[model samples]
Target: MAHRFQYTVISILSAVLQKCGLRCTRKFGKMLGLLLMLQTKRRMITYDNISKAYPGHSDEWKGALVRGAYVNLGITFAEMLYSKALSADDLINQVTFSGLDVVAERARNGLPSILLSGHFGNWEYLAMAAGVCLHKPLTIVVHPQHNAYLDAELNTIRTRFGNIVVPMHKAARTLVRTIQEGGIVAFLADQHASADHDPQIEFFGRPTPTYSAPAALALKFNVPMFLGTAVRHDTGKYSVNVQPVPSADLSDNPESVIELTHRHVAMLESEIRANPHLWSWQHRRWRM
Candidate 1:
């Protein structure tokens, strides 16, 4: 009964989003974000996080950033909903890709690579577009959504353009199989992991719990890792940037895991730093 209700809601939302199209939906999302910041107290979390990261900035500077972040969050939410209704025509015009041949080259040379990225820009679109952009099937490791029905729907959209999704629990086995078979694997590596056991890495001038799976996998497989990001442009479009993480000197070892992990985190931080407004800052990433 609950699943039926969820499906009904999703169908109605998808229809409305499809009608509104990407551009207008994004405008709606921006407005939604503004309303959220103005009406809700969650803006406090945004302000606090910004202060910690950019302590030297004045309150006005920080507030402007926070507004941008909230607007980004709203735009992202709308985009994700519209993803379900996205057509190839809509995707092609809305997002553009660069540096894909670099990673795709690995497969041509019998090398399987790990793609690392963060929650910057339209991350969901980044993965979704990479499916078609790379000209090859991408194996994405994602955390499962609590709602089984919703999770199924997400995978449907994710795989619509020739990509695969594997849940976190099954990621180890699936990634190994894919890598051994000379396939590409992607990971969203920017989120804060459980601090209880996860190693803390320096990010944005502070030690933060970071996921090391991608680093470990890259080292163990002795394959190259590519750091990618889908950045938003003033034209209301997205541009994907993919480049290799400089780690040719590192061998498969515990030390390499830490070093590679830091390198990827730093890469993500650089992107977030370059475009501070494109990132979601209200999630309270800095526990300190």
Candidate 2:
């Protein structure tokens, strides 16, 4: 009953967002972002994150970035709500692709790859748009939302355009199989991986815990890897950049895993630094 009610609320929000269309949804979602910014605790988490990353910045600047981060998140959610109503053409038309030659070459040679991105921009579309663009689907690893009903509802959008979804915990076998089959697999490497056993990487100049599985797996399988992100423009249009991560030359070993992890994490950090607003700052990503 609780899960059903939660989903009902999301459905209501989705309806409103869908009706607004892309441009208007950006406007509407910012309004929602303003409201979300009022939540003191989470807002501070966002603010603190910004401050830690940019210690020299003035309070006003950090505040504005924090606000923009929430607004970015709001817009991401608004855009996602519209996914259910989008056909393949609608999805493809709204997003432009860049730096895709690497993926194209891999496809031509029947090779598998590890696609990685952070929580920046419309990361969902990063994996979604690649399929029809290349005529090959991707296996995407996802974190399961606690709300089982909402999880299914959200994943429905993910799979609608010919992608396979695997929850993080049970994804090991599927990931191995996909690589062996010469299929692409995607993972978001920005989320917190806080287990004591988890390896730490330098993120934003701090020793931050990160998900290293993507790097480890890529090294283990000796697969080519790429990092990509979807940048949502003010007009609500998006441009995706899929750049090669230069992993093929690395020998598959423990040291290689760490090096690959650092490389991808640095790429994401640079993206966030370039556009702080596009990345989510709400997570307790860094320890004080």
Q: Pick the candidate with the highest TM-score.
A: 2
Model 2, stretches more than 4 Å misplaced?
Answer: none
- lDDT minimum window of 10 residues, candidate 2: 17-26
List TM-scores for all candidates, in order: 0.92, 0.95
Clashing pairs in 1: none
- Whole-model lDDT per candidate: 0.84, 0.84
lDDT of 2 by residue, 1-288 (tens): 998998999899888777777777777777888889889999988888888899999999998899889988887877788777777888789888898778877877889988888888888866777876777888999999999988998898888888999999899999999999889999998877875857789998889988888888888888878887788786777888888787766887888888999999999888778788999999787753
lDDT of 1: 0.84
Report lDDT (Cα) of residue 269, candidate 1.
Answer: 89
